[model samples]
Target: MNSSRGVLELPPVVGRFVDGVGTFLADDVDEGRPIRCRFLWSAITPTSCRWEQAFSTYGGRGWETNWVMEFTRTGRDCTNNG
Candidate 1:
């Protein structure tokens, strides 16, 4: 599996709160293939956010939704760093 981490920067849309996307790659060790995973997310509040992720094999099939996650920001520093 790929162990490296990557960052994606997306320009803010006119009315959106999301700043970017995050991507992670992993190998399907059992199938001896590589898989691509992506996160599409946005901050909903100073203390919370929502996101969805998808996965697919390279050049194989279309992406499938793996999960949707929503969580509260744990700390007080929920400032925009971008």
Candidate 2:
């Protein structure tokens, strides 16, 4: 990871770092395996944000994806209350 400040910045709501765990087909062919992913938020606003993720398998090559999403605030919490 780079130590230089201001290299990446994000809003408080977007979080500085995010992590995800899942399984995906290797090369879109093989059986799914556990994958760990990390995301860094580079830009964020009240209604939109942009980030990128790096994914790595337990014993395989890594991949990445960039994402941008627009959000609308519903008066609901971000958790499963049911």
Report the error of model 1 at residue 78, Å: 14
Model 2 TM: 0.29
Error of 1 at 73 (Å): 4.6
TM-score of 1: 0.43
The alpha-carbon deviation from the true structure for residue 67 of candidate 2, after best TM-score superposition, in angstroms, is 4.7
Q: Which regions in candidate 2 have their CA more than 4 angstroms from the true location? A: 1-30, 58-62, 66-82
lDDT values for all models:
0.56, 0.44
Give lDDT: candidate 1, residue 51.
83
Q: For every candidate structure, what is the RMSD over all alpha carbons to the true structure, in angstroms?
A: 8.8, 14.7
Q: Report the CA-based lDDT of candidate 2 relative to the real structure.
A: 0.44
lDDT of 1 by residue, 1-82 (tens): 2335555533222223335444443334225556555556665677777787666775436788879999896775547753
